[model samples]
Target: MATYDAALVLLVDSSEAVLLQHRDDQGLVSPNQWSLPGGHVELGETPEQAAHRELFRETGLTTSELRALWSGPWPYEAASRIR
Candidate 1:
């Protein structure tokens, strides 16, 4: 059996362009590719909280309005495009 982890994909749209980050080569899933801002969901932490933390850490952007678009037990790897 494998330990599964939760994650959230952070997105921002200010009536302009969306954000995206590139994942470094890791010899796993997507490498040196593109993905949205996201990361592992913390214990006892809501998906929104996780997204809030990731968005700043990954993109250095903050917003008063935080929303979750999607989430699941997907084994996402490495840093990818943040949109």
Candidate 2:
């Protein structure tokens, strides 16, 4: 069993429009797909920290306010890897 930790940010504007990023077509994962601004959580970092880092790294936007929508295991099985 392998566990991969990740964090994502749901950015909403005053107009209730949400922000999303288009993944690179040649990217290794989820190529050319729309996604929230986020990435894997680094060692020694909390999910909140990773969310802030990924949001700025991907969108150049920063915010001090964040609310967690969900947290738990997301299980998936492919080949012999479980996550």
Q: Candidate 1 lDDT, tens digit per residue, 1-83?
A: 23334454556477767788897897243568898876767778888887878888878987778766666665443323221
In the range 1-83, model 2's lDDT, one tens digit per residue, is 43467788999999999999999998544679999988767779888988999899999999999887866443323312321
lDDT of each: 0.66, 0.77
Strongest candidate by TM-score:
2
- Candidate 2 local accuracy as lDDT? 0.77
- What overall lDDT, based on C-alpha atoms, would model 1 receive against the true structure? 0.66
TM-score for model 1? 0.67
Candidate 2 clashes between residue pairs 3 or more apart in a chain or in different chains: none
Give per-residue lDDT, candidate 1, residue 77.
38
Number of the predicted model whose lDDT against the real structure is largest: 2
- Which sections of candidate 2 miss by over 4 Å? 73-83
If candidate 2 were superposed on the true structure by all CA atoms, what would the RMSD be? 3.5
